[model samples]
Target: MAKCDACGTTILFGGKRMGDQRYCNDTCAGQGVLLNRVRQIPDGDVVAFANQVHSGNCPKCSGQGPVDVRDSYQVWSAILFTRWKSTPHILCRRCGVKAQAGDLAISAVAGWWGFPWGLLMTPVQVGRNIWSMAVAHNPNQPSDALLRQARLILAQRSLQDGRSQG
Candidate 1:
């Protein structure tokens, strides 16, 4: 058995292979690619790149004080299967609040149809969205996860620019 490169899950059988790295699924493969890109950036440069992103405008609304927010929503069908999704967004406080409101509404409406998992996850996701909204109320600085994502974005852009010039 081989351990997944992105997430350390024991792979019992066939798995997606990218070069020498093996991943359990497509999502893991995509994450592995991103991890590789992030690794290309030097450790000393991460803080500088994050600072640059912090000073820049929000990618969505072009507003200041952009912060990272992740909201989870759940949906279940036929008392058998449950689907949950967590989406991350980098937006100003106003935009983040709007997005969280949508997630909250959706989770409240569609998150309680299935079995034990749906019952268990619905309230949790709803509370999580509420918490995210409360945190977004005071957008002072970018969160650490936001800073890391910013560094990754800047590093990817720089690599693309270098490739284009060469």
Candidate 2:
């Protein structure tokens, strides 16, 4: 068994491989990632760049092993609906339009159970929040009516896909 160079944890099967495979899992892997992203430190001559990462806890479900969104319809369905990352703008494939990011929350909201609930939450609700945030952030992007229609389209698409497959 290979031991992680950083944490000394035994590298399990499927853990990412690097230089004989350090770090037992992605959390540890992130430490190295964060370290690398910060180029300079100290001496009063340093600025930290923003670290962009998918918000919320690990989305993978573990049972019998680690099951990812790709493995099950339910998981994949959630992934299809969930926003992977926040961007200042996104390219819309439908109309070939570029959209400015709205006032969407930068972090995923947690439910009463202390778990990431945004993915499990309704896409219409989430999408509405995103659309509202978007229009509020930049009125130049699209009208609220147009954004609402887009959100409904996305939510409906997800529902249709889920029903068709699951």
Query: 57, model 2: CA deviation in Å?
Result: 33
Give lDDT tens digits, candidate 2, residues 130-157.
5533332231233333333334434445
lDDT of each: 0.75, 0.34
| Candidate 2 displacement at residue 101 in angstroms | 42
RMSD of 1: 3.3
lDDT of 1 by residue, 1-166 (tens): 7999999999998999999999999999988877888888776677666655556777788887544544545444348677777787766677767877898888788888878878888898888888877754334555677667766786668767878999
10 residues in a row with least lDDT, candidate 2: 66-75
Q: Which window of 10 residues has the lowest lDDT sum in candidate 1?
A: 69-78
Best by lDDT: 1
| Model 1 TM | 0.75
